[model samples]
Target: MTAVQGLEGKMMNKYGYGTDYYGYRKKFVVLVPSTNTAVESEYHLMKPTGVALATRACVIPSIKVTNEEEFVGLVKAIGDATEQGLKDALSCEPDHVIFGYSAETFWDGKERSDREFKRYNDIAQAVGGCNITFGAQAIQDALACYPGVKKIAVISPYMPVGDNMVIKFLEDIGYEVTAIKGHCSPGAVEIAHEPFGKTRELVQAVNSADCDLILQAGTNLHFAELAGSLEAELGKPVLAINTITFWHALRTNGIPDRIKGFGSLLSEH
Candidate 1:
């Protein structure tokens, strides 16, 4: 061997690094509500190889659910907290940022939602100097997988106000919502504690042949695993917000690993 080959072989022989766990491809910064406990776990469950997820939480002190007024106030508070959380996440110098919360995604209508998304996008661009993913846009992209799907069954852990916002957004985007079943959970923390079995029941409650697909919102409800099973039984897509959001983040970053048991969006699309 030549002198350069001998030196390279000696260096290789003396030291070695183990296999890369994350492939060192891209780092993902995730933002969620402080009371949320499900986003991190679900994201990890479906995360593809070569991708790393780092999370930061927006503070939501308490949830007061007496009436619509309190609900509106809580949403505003969550929005404020999300802004701070986004700032914190951008400090990580991630390749991309993922918004793991869903309620704020649906505002008054499509125009308002688009404006809000642009605002968040601008902040992410300025701070992280990278692309960002939102749950609302992911859901819309997931729906595109089912070309003939015009009507859908919906389930959420939000109150009536939040549910209405979601419905309005979908309708404005040209999809008909056949039915929406809200758990009306007390607050963010409570929503995180919702049992997966209960979510399955909600799917059953809203599901019908009339609807083309089933969609579960509320990122903290833990529906990734259940979505796969429900899709098999119903013979249609059962998309959880977390699954689509993660899928979008990965695809937007050009990571196309097929993740199984989470639903077709990650596995097939």
Candidate 2:
């Protein structure tokens, strides 16, 4: 083998990681919004053998976000609760962290996203050298797997303001957002209550002939399975935020599991 390939083979383990039994392959700490109810279960569904996941929710008030002001407050509340959430999650001594919230990562575009990732990394380093993976960066990495992808359609459980932020981040990274649809879910918890049919409706609304891919945001929204199913019917790739983030976490941590049924992002790429 080449020298680099030899080094990689030494690093990639054949058994569980760290000191856990269940998380024998890898131990992952996932942080989500306190009011969210979908992310943990979705992560479990996509979880591979010899992997373990512990979810910590960043506490936030379960209130309606009808306007931009309340939406901003919701964002602030998640921010206020995040540091403590990370500290609590670190007690498990996981190998990696998946920050389940997507808004902050896409808030001010790529520069701010990079800064926030570094900050989360610093916190993880303080405890035991674990690193963090965020949705915006993960989605970017997932998209890069398809070289011809240029225009994309987006769906999010966010307000118009929040969708604009997602658009800003995608555009900053040189992807053309062909269309976007935001659910404006009444509250944070309500995002989990969103029905599965909404995904098909949103996809139909935003997808165009020229669209190269369809990406769904909102970790709390249950769309992972739907993404895989839709790809078969749409004849293009559909990426769910949770799957992309978890996939990124798994691959970057030296877990080369080519899990199927979660779209080509996981199964093929």
Global CA lDDT computed for model 1 = 0.83
Best by lDDT: 2
lDDT by residue (tens digit), candidate 1, 1-269: 34455446546655544322343556898888887889999999987656678888888886856666777777788788877788888987888889988888887877877887888889999987987898787787888888999998899998889889989989988999999998888776788788878887888899988999888888888898989988888899889999999999988888878999988888999
For every model shown, what is its TM-score relative to the native structure?
0.90, 0.92
Pick by TM-score: which candidate is best? 2
On the 0 to 100 scale, the lDDT of residue 20 in model 2 is 62
lDDT (C-alpha) at residue 200 in model 1: 79
How much is the lDDT of residue 225 in candidate 2? 92
Q: Any residue pairs clashing in model 1, and if so which?
A: none
Stretches of candidate 1 off by over 4 Å are 1-23
